[model samples]
Target: MDELRAQLIATARAMGSAGLNKGTAGNLSVRAAAGFLITPTGMDYASLECADIPWMSLEGEARGRRRPSSEWRFHRDIYAARPEVGAVLHAHSPFAVSLACLRREIPPFHYMIARFGGTTVRCGAYALFGTQALSDAALAALEGRSACLLANHGMLVAGRDLKQALDLGIELESLCEQYWRACQLGEPVLLSAAEMAEVLEHFRHYGQQSGQQSGGKTS
Candidate 1:
């Protein structure tokens, strides 16, 4: 619990340092034994302490002094559905917000788009924040992907761990910014479906053989 709390706090501060968030505009959570440990609502990250974090159950009860983030619903829902997702990061990064505000899904303008699990990054339908409706939209958008843009909101990404989640969010923001810049000049040339399919195959096995290569036990 102590280590996880520290990591959650560090992740929050890291988001601010990376300019992926401002004020308390974003939230993060990691899957825990009970349910998950999430950032508290309406509190400045700078003033946050380990004790300030809230442990929320899958059924939505929070067991802590501070209330969970209003967006905790989606985090809880994601954990319930995706067992591999150890951590989730949501941020109001500038580029991602700009694209999301337009309510558009990002196509495969770059090869790295496959990192999120498909040829495009979905944009969830806009719904009121903290509502089950918004969670539903987010879940639909993330059906086969690990990252998505919350329409008129921002970015939500999941990863095997907190570090990976933070990394994915940063990379997604970078891609969004790059795509935004391309739009300034003209339509960005996107990769073809077949080309993306080919790339996706390569990505599938790229990281899976690491243990084998290191002569470590695979199971």
Candidate 2:
């Protein structure tokens, strides 16, 4: 899995460089048959390497050189709860954290928010790190959606793969920034539930079409 490890390190660094995280304030994980590879605790993304990554079992036992990120519990719980999730990303992006601290949900202010497949992006209640309570809350908040903001902390996003997870993280942070800016102008204009449902349906069909095109090209 050296290639996967290398990709993880590179993607983590890219996320940080893109301002999706600061210092060592983010963690990333990708599913593996035995368990998963995750970022190490207290390691800066800019200098991360494949050797610095840690492996943890689905049961949360450490299996590699370094201790996994303190949010290992969060990642483990997510993987356990959602078998379809092949990658997880947690980041303390500025706008998302700001909204989380304010205890506000990311409303459906734009069609891009439809990627979440819900009326609004939920926020899990604050719980201490590495605790089962936080993991449980996060799972609940993420229901019917690919991502959720962690109250007073950051965000948790899951995807079918690492690239998709990274994309979701970026989209979430961008939506948060837009919401914040719109609020500054006046009362933010939010899409109604029916409108959001229509948007979500469109997204679902679009995804199907794209998948078909990709399959056709590969074949």
Candidate 3:
């Protein structure tokens, strides 16, 4: 349990190091034997100790010295809805936010967009943060994709594990930034659905399709 807590903390700190988050603006969680260990709300990840991480049940029951993030509802909803998810990452990355503010969806401007499990990355409908409505909206956007932009909010991602979630979050911000830049010049050329369908098929075998983590993430 201690090791898992430490790993969760390490992953949170890594987000800071990579600039995926700052201060306490973002939250991360890893599935636990009982429920899950999530970064406490409004607490600086930089100063967190193992005990500072709180455990919360899928039923929304929280246990620990600190309070779970206000967004805990969605975390709980996600775990209950997606059996394969081991971790969830939420970030307010600048580029993603810029596009999100406009409720823009990341289209198949690049074939690499298939890394998210589709030809286009969806932008969820606007909902106030920390509400069940927000979770509902996020879940809808993430239906067939591992990552989605929260309209006028930020980004929500889930993975099979902590490392996968963190790495994907970084990659997502990069893609959003690239797409944002492309839009500055002119409308970016989008790939065909058939083309991206093929990429999705190839991604299934990317690296280790047999026993390796295919897609290696959860929505």
lDDT for model 1, on a 0 to 1 scale?
0.91
Worst 10 residues of 2 by lDDT: 210-219
The whole-model C-alpha lDDT of candidate 3 against the native structure comes to 0.89
Tell me the deviation in Å of residue 119 in model 2.
1.4
Report lDDT per candidate.
0.91, 0.85, 0.89
Instruction: Assess the local accuracy of residue 134 in candidate 3 as a C-alpha lDDT between 0 and 100.
Output: 96
Candidate 3 clashing pairs? none
Q: Compared with the true structure, what per-residue lDDT tens digits does model 2 show for residues 40-141?
A: 999888787778888899888887788899888878888888777888999999999999999888887887887865778999999998788998999999
Worst 10 residues of 1 by lDDT: 210-219
Residue 164 Cα positional deviation in candidate 2, in Å, after optimal superposition: 0.6
**C-alpha RMSD for every candidate:** 3.0, 3.3, 1.7
State candidate 1's TM-score: 0.95
Candidate 3 ranges with C-alpha deviation above 4 Å = 209-219
lDDT for each residue of candidate 1 in 106-128, tens digit (9 for 90 to 100) = 99999899889999999999999
Q: Looking at model 3, which ten-residue stretch has the lowest summed lDDT? A: 210-219
